[model samples]
Target: METKQTDIKLKTPIRCIVKLGGAAITCKNEFEKINEANLITVSSQLREAMMFGSSSGSVLEMDWSKRPGMAESLVKVDDYKEQLVLDFSSFVVIHGAGSFGHFQASTSGVHRGGLNQPLVKAGFVATRISVTSLNLEIVRALAREGIPSVAMSPFSCGWSTRERNIASADVSAVVEALDSGFVPVLHGDAVLDEALGCTILSGDVIISHLAAHLKPQFVVFLTDVFGVYDRPPAEPNAVLLREIAVREDGSWSVVNPTLEDSDKQVEISVASHDTTGGMVTKISEAAMIAKHGIDVYIVKAATEHSLTALSGKLRDKIPDDWLGTVIRHVS
Candidate 1:
């Protein structure tokens, strides 16, 4: 006589949110095109991070001759896909639109507020199509890797104010998907606004809201550069900031505050098409989440294994050498 298998229940797994920056996943200079090779590598990193639970996992090695973008670097990716004994409990993936939606958003001024003119409204529709295409591509890539990833649109259940900030959102579907063991993949999108006709909702802002609600153990922002820098990484003397710590009152320490006013904000670059606030906005948002007592990591994803490092697979992974930055709150 066999016992009923239905009686068994699984406990909730630890949850995490990972955002793949548009520039990291796609060539921001290119129009509506994804960096297929880079996408493959990043997606594989995500899978490997979830599959292996320890430092013994394989490392991704770089092969520069394969592609000009990832050239001149070797990376370590965990090679034990078959031998991994652990599994990721839960994951929420949010990705920026890069050239896809940014092109339309900036032209239409959607990020500023809403669609007032007919031309701007047309651009809104165009932006939606572009981002949706990219989102699907990401979902399909994860699916092929055997991760049950589901594409979710903020446009369907998200809301914003006339000032172009997220007001309220019905993320029940997202929560439901995660509870059901599906990796919900969300992308920055142009959504309906209460006062403004419509506005562009950025992925960084979306992740913050999700972090508040879901209270994930960690949040990872995978960007093009090596985390937060004292100055733009291109500058001759720019330095990478390893961590940003939050104070008891929720204030954050500005990294190498170089501005005249002593503002902690660091200067960051945005592609011409980008309507979102770019690097500065990303750091601000991550800091906000950190204030809520959640740990956030900003790292370079295109040419590094920062994802695995954040996943805590390697016990001795150095933030500076790994090109990763940590954001946290402390009393």
Candidate 2:
């Protein structure tokens, strides 16, 4: 018997996982209302990218449950998905629950609250309903854009934990979609489980999972700030880490250290307990994926040139300290 090699050619057009941070879609400042103008601007850029075929697919991950009148937001996402499909004819999308599940999980102190809480049943119900509503908005949005987009829930897709398992399923779906020439839109949502009960999946986790499985040329994490700042941006001389090297200990080291005596080392930290993953989780996850030889870019979504930067078309146009971090394998 002859042994045959499995020749699975990587899909074309460059498969990428574009993470739209919740903070980018929500309030930049406490006093400011939702940034509708910025939202529209970003959406237009995405539309243009799809129109010209710069991006193979896109995913919008936000926490809609926390927002007021979430039903309305869902409508917006659906409308956008629809428009994109009609206009561009190809593209994948994913969104997160803005605030729907965040509040409940936070208050209950149950990282996976909805599964077994009878007292907080009302909250759980509301969260699920709100997520569904938000999904509708994404669908409608794709319709309006003439792009065919689909909404997926954790429960529906068999996501029950915050570990690599969730990432596995998500990546499987994305790969399936790409192989069949369909765009898969995923979002952060509450998933029901009999084993761990119920848990809220974070968008960052989803992105990390995709990168690990797909091993794309690069992964792009878009946020409100220009990129990761050297200081907190409030202080003077706050610089950005242009490139990060993954260490054997699974930590990221910047070229420049913040203090003279201190090592130029930093670990991505989780944002909150309610959220499944955070910056730290993302960095760690990206580092793991990089070990297999992948590059990750953390950039500011607010920058109009973000898409161009990721596409490697405007390399000379971006500044040195653009407010983001790049993680790559040293070896």
Clash totals in order:
11, 62
Worst 10 residues of 2 by lDDT: 1-10
Per-residue lDDT for 154-174 in model 2, tens only?
657666563224522534555
Which TM-score value belongs to model 2?
Answer: 0.71
- Which is the leading candidate under TM-score? 1
Model 1, 163-272: lDDT tens per residue?
57776676677767876777899999998777777888889998987787677778889988878887789999876777667786666765432334334556677667
Score candidate 2 by lDDT.
Answer: 0.55
Which candidate has the highest lDDT of all? 1
Output the TM-score of candidate 1.
Answer: 0.81
Worst 10 residues of 1 by lDDT: 1-10
Q: After superposition, how far is residue 289 of candidate 1 from its true place, in Å?
A: 0.6
Mark the regions of model 2 whose C-alpha exceeds 4 Å error after superposition: 1-14, 28-34, 51-96, 110-114, 162-172, 193-195, 235-237, 256-274, 314-323
